[model samples]
Target: MSERLKSFIRERATALGFEACRFASASAPWDAGERLAHFVGEGRHGDMGWMETTLERRAHPTAMWPEAKTAVVLGLNYGPEADPLPQMADRSAGYLSVYARGDDYHEVIKGRLKILAGQMAARTGQDVKVFVDTAPLMEKPLAQRAGLGWQGKHTNLLSRRHGNWLFLGSILTTAEIEPDAPEGEHCGSCTACLDACPTAAFPAPFQLDARRCLSYLTIEFAGPWPEEFRVATGSRIYGCDDCLAVCPWNKFASGAREARLHAREALNAPRLADLLALDDPAFRALFAKSPVKRIGRDRFVRNVLYAAGNSGDAGLVEPVGALLGDPDPVVRDAAAWALRRLEAAGLA
Candidate 1:
């Protein structure tokens, strides 16, 4: 009966366009709770208050939702058609991470997870709750335990066929399914992921310092960016992906199935000068579909102006200088800083 249920769930996931699916029981695995507590205690999640709010709930699925018996994990690949690594060298244009270049994964992945859960409810009459990254569930570890993929050296799940470009979602159901054997670690002696981080976010092989992670700093944290990190941020206006991109495992995966994940023409290589001119309405209109919308106009512009300071281009002076009196203090402060950096370098 369990085997039949597992097969059925896998079929449902594939039909829903999910690249892969696996099952993990509600019980926490192999010191998962203690490790998680340690991670949080160290304040590694940075200023993502949501992580702190959801602490107790994240350690175990059953604790978060009383009825959760089976976790049906799903993976979606959102890698781009082109290699994003080369663009990092382009000082004239700002680089937004590949994940943020497309439609927001939160909306896209959540919709599909909900639809998959809806189908299961219709077929089995089981109560189910859908969760994407929004929940505090230890998603990566659960994925590894469920045999979706092993957590690679970079701490993201990896598959021989799909690489590290997967977005994970879960359907926690009251119904049970047979579980697959957990995947074994395949990283071996490779430290490619560790070597690639610009800010050295991965202090050890598998652990990450969220404070140094560009994704955490730019999107999750709101106030002025920490002073020490400004120079290391470079022109990465959004998340950083050097670690993921450098992984040799990605060669097997294809581009995203969703066309919206493709980089927009304007955003693929935006000039620093262009982003500084983006006021609230203008920014919203421009990024409605893209993931960069989460950071809002002020934070996004602040990030862009940080890049403008690094841009070392006199052409950015007038555009970036204009934000000094902007409505958002964050943007104004960042603008003042950029203008000074530009003038100091004699680019102004």
Candidate 2:
């Protein structure tokens, strides 16, 4: 009966657009709490203080909800149609992480998770709770235990079929279900992800220093970027995908077909000049459904200004210069920094 229910869940998930769905015991297979403790203890999470606040709950699924007995980990692919790294060469245009170029994954994956959750509750008469990257839940480990994928050295889930471009969502339930065999590590000796990082975010395999991660700096981080990372950040305005793109396993992954997950042409390689010009209203309007909107106009433009500074295109100087006196001090500071860099390089 458990096997039948598992089959039913996986079928429904696939039909609902999830590329993969597998189950894991709510207890989790690894010492997730200790691992998290080590990460937080070493100060690797950086300014993401929330991780510290939710440490106890994130230690394990049962810690979040004692009644939960099974975890249904699901993966939704958002693979790019072409290589994203090449766009970095055009420093005048911004490179958005593939995952953020479309509708926010939280909204997209949550809707599907809720639909699947409702179906599961009806089938098993069990209480269900859904999570899509918002919770403190350790999703990658759960996904790995469920056999959806193994955690790559980059610290994101990597599937034989979906690679690293997968968004994870989970349905925790009161139902007792048999868990699937765990996926064995397939990363082998490859260090491509670690070497590809522009910020050297990874101190070692399977460990990430979020402080140096461009994605963290551009998005979660507020205030001016550290001087050291400004040039290395290149033209990436929102998030960086270098580590994910360089993975060897992506050869088995396919481009995303979900209409909502596909990149909007305008966002594919947005002009740095145009991005720097976005006022609050324009920013909101332009990125209404995009994950990039979460950072708000000031932070977003700050990232653009940094990119503009790194861009050897002197033509971008006018836009960067205009923001030097903006209301937001963060924007003003970034503008000043960009101006200095551009002027020193004779690009301003």
Best by TM-score: 2
What's each prediction's clash count?
A: 0, 0
TM-score of each: 0.95, 0.98
Please give, for residues 77-166, the per-residue lDDT of candidate 1 as tens digits: 887776688997877688988888878888888878888888888877889988888777778888888887888777778887788888
Alpha carbon deviation, residue 131, candidate 2 (Å):
0.5
Instruction: Write down the lDDT that model 2 would get.
Output: 0.91
- In candidate 1, which residue pairs get closer than 3 Å at backbone N, Cα or C atoms, i.e. clash? none
**Candidate 2 displacement at residue 294 in angstroms:** 0.9
The lDDT per prediction is 0.83, 0.91
Candidate 2's residue-wise lDDT over 1-348, tens digit each? 999999999899989999888899996446878989999999988889999999999999999998999999998889998788998889889999999888998998899899999999999999999998888899999988999888899988889987888888999999999999999889999999999999999988998888899999999999787898988898989989999999999999899878899999999999999988899999999999999888899999999999988998899889999998899999999999999998999875
The top-ranked prediction according to lDDT is 2
